[model samples]
Target chain A: MEEEAETESITLQDSAAGGRIDGKWGYIWGAYSVTWVLLVGYTLSLVLRGRLLRRSSGVER
Target chain B: MKLPFAWEHLIGVIALLLFCYGQVFGLFMVPPDAHMGDVARILFVHVPSAWNAFFVFTIAFVCALGYLISGRKGFDHALEAALEVGILLTILLLMTGSIFAKPTWDVWWKWEPRLTSSAIMLMTYVGVVVLRSVVQDNERRAVWSSAATILASVTLPLTYFSVQIWRSIHQIQTSPADIDAPLRMAWRINALAVLLLATWFLARRWRIAARRWELGDAPPLPEPLQPEEV
Candidate 1:
């Protein structure tokens, strides 16, 4: 009986986690993720530009 | 004669302090929106970024005009500083707006009037930069760029009011007459954030310009750039 209860509890926890994950409005997740990706990409571009500028200036010198 | 002063570091320090203070105030002190819950917190970043983008463009417009009228290197330097800062701030504005839109509007991207107009404005400045690269003569580049900047400035008001003039997916940026207290506080924090970012970018870009000039690679502000030899 104890083993059965333990299994039942585990199943219930798994279902609860699944519900939380699936129940969320999917569009919100897409919006947040896309924004994060774009912002990071832009930051990387800025860094690369700075590095290139530095390299080219060094070459000129 | 007294030497020309550059207070780049001093301005940067002040801007950094403001950003820190704005962040703290935004995340902690501002009350959450009852309708949108804690997700509305993103406004603290988004609204400020939009403001800075507009403000920087205005500075670029004015500086471009000054450069054309005075034919001075200082004005050109100011215009370049404003352009670099404006582009970065415009990018920040778009990123923040899209991020904030998710919880509020339920979409990552929308064909909203304000959003479309702002994107076009940014692209126009980018076109100006490309045009400068294609032209070999410095004087011609400056003259053409100044014209572009002037045209861009004239469109600023229309872009700002586009939403009001036509129906859009977005609402008016800010309306104190309608907003509740919690939302108002959030908007104030956003305003502070915008000011902080503007100061920071302006100072940093100015320092970068100064270093470029010191390195002797930057185009002379007063002398028009001559055509390059093959």
Candidate 2:
């Protein structure tokens, strides 16, 4: 019981000092992953659409 | 024969390199925020996306005005491209902002002034795009869409200033003094990277629009039925 109380106090102190919720790295990584996925996917779609349009129109760069 | 180089290609390469560098610097080198900790890294992407959305919308606004004044098809095409790219970036901004808010604000969404105004601005432009698709006449579509684009752009400034104009939980725009040096550096680099990438996308989108304008929107007609079959 004494050791449990000590650990709880340390956790409270850490939270107070940092002003951060512990174990929020998942949110951080999730945000970054979603961002990259959207960016890459959108870019690919743009490129493929452009290519298809060029082919259909018989336009050459 | 290929010239072996183009300005757009060069910009794409440079933007890619700068983006990689900025992401590396931001994700690995910059220290976490005192309050938000690692979650603050989301700002590197979120802020740049917001800025690019604003930048593209501004371009669209100018193009719309130009089309109105000169009646130029080029301006209309440019407006179309910018509106598309701007909407895409705005969607990205909202998604990233929501993701950041989840941990920081303990909510996935909010109807605060800034957030609400951004959603309105996004939907307004989206409506403009949809308006264009449903209108069949080229000249009529151009005129109507340009008008809508200009009217929708009024919301851009509102969205930018929403945090200041209303009581809100969202943080106000930060000044240079408020940011740490390394984080500011990362932010600036990422901002430029997004700007360049946006330029590339705008150019490509514009080309596609111009090509479509030239080719016309009519579907290819089916070959006449065979005489024997008829």
Candidate 3:
């Protein structure tokens, strides 16, 4: 049983590593950057909204 | 209340700055892919957006659960805001993924497991939104929205495990346990981006809810009475 499990694990590792490194690093990175843009944009939006809310609330301290 | 740059807001800003730094490192400095060329760059955006959508939805679900268990209006409002942001992120994910898919798959759409599950996930969130809008009273809206949020969580696990549960052809290059050096850096950056965005949206939405609460339970402004004949 242990031997069977070992073999299965090796096979899974092999399958996981089967892919050749594709040459499209640019697109992969671009997709990542797009996510960053969204994040930054959203953060800025929150900051703006927070400011608005505080002003409206007029709660000191 | 006090100037909006509370500690949380400051932390959010710092996190966002770090996220930007990561984006620059991931996009410009990262080496190109040997197989997919520049198109591989799409993963930086597409993967992160998809993950963020799921993260937002999960938060929404938890908030809804909090409301159900504790009956806090804050939790209800948080659930609503989280759902709103989740829907936005999900829509962005679908659009970006579609664009990425077109070049790689040689077609506009494919009924693949991830894509299909994501569609279902989106539909469930939309239903939650509709339920919230239809309800009249604030408490009723909160109750209905919370229920919808809780129920919609069913789609979350499905969307998350869809690839593993089914035989998916889409490449599963990045796993947390074992990541290649280059891909690892890129993935980390993408994650940072998601975290920053999620924090920003949550904080902003929370503030909005706080503001609404502070305003008290006043009924919405009656149609402005036209100035009575002067």
Candidate 2, residues A31-50, lDDT tens digits: the string is 77887888788789888877
TM-score of the second chain in candidate 1: 0.81
TM-score of each: 0.70, 0.87, 0.77
DockQ for every model comes to 0.04, 0.23, 0.23
Candidate 1 positional error at B92, Å: 0.9
- The segments of candidate 3 whose C-alpha lies over 4 angstroms from its true place after superposition are A1-61, B1-4, B213-225
Please write out the lDDT profile of model 2 over residues B66-111, one tens digit for every residue: 9999999999989989999899889889998998888777788989
Query: For each candidate, how many residue pairs have backbone atoms clashing (under 3 Å)?
Result: 2, 0, 30
Docking class of 3: incorrect
* Ten contiguous residues with the weakest lDDT in model 2 chain A: A9-18
- Taking the tens digit of each residue's C-alpha lDDT, what string does model 1 give over B1-230? 64365454455456556655665665567665544445556666667667777888899899889978988766665666688667776776777677666545557678778888888888888877777567655566668888888987866787789877764556554568767775676667657645654565565555545445444544323243477831
Cα lDDT, model 2, residue B34: 67
Q: State candidate 3's TM-score.
A: 0.77
Enumerate residue pairs that collide in model 1. B73-B221, B138-B225
lDDT of 3 by residue, B43-159 (tens): 666777778788888899889889888988889778878987898788778876875666566555789888898899999899988997667677777888888788889998888
Error of 2 at B29 (Å): 0.6
- lDDT for model 3 comes to 0.70
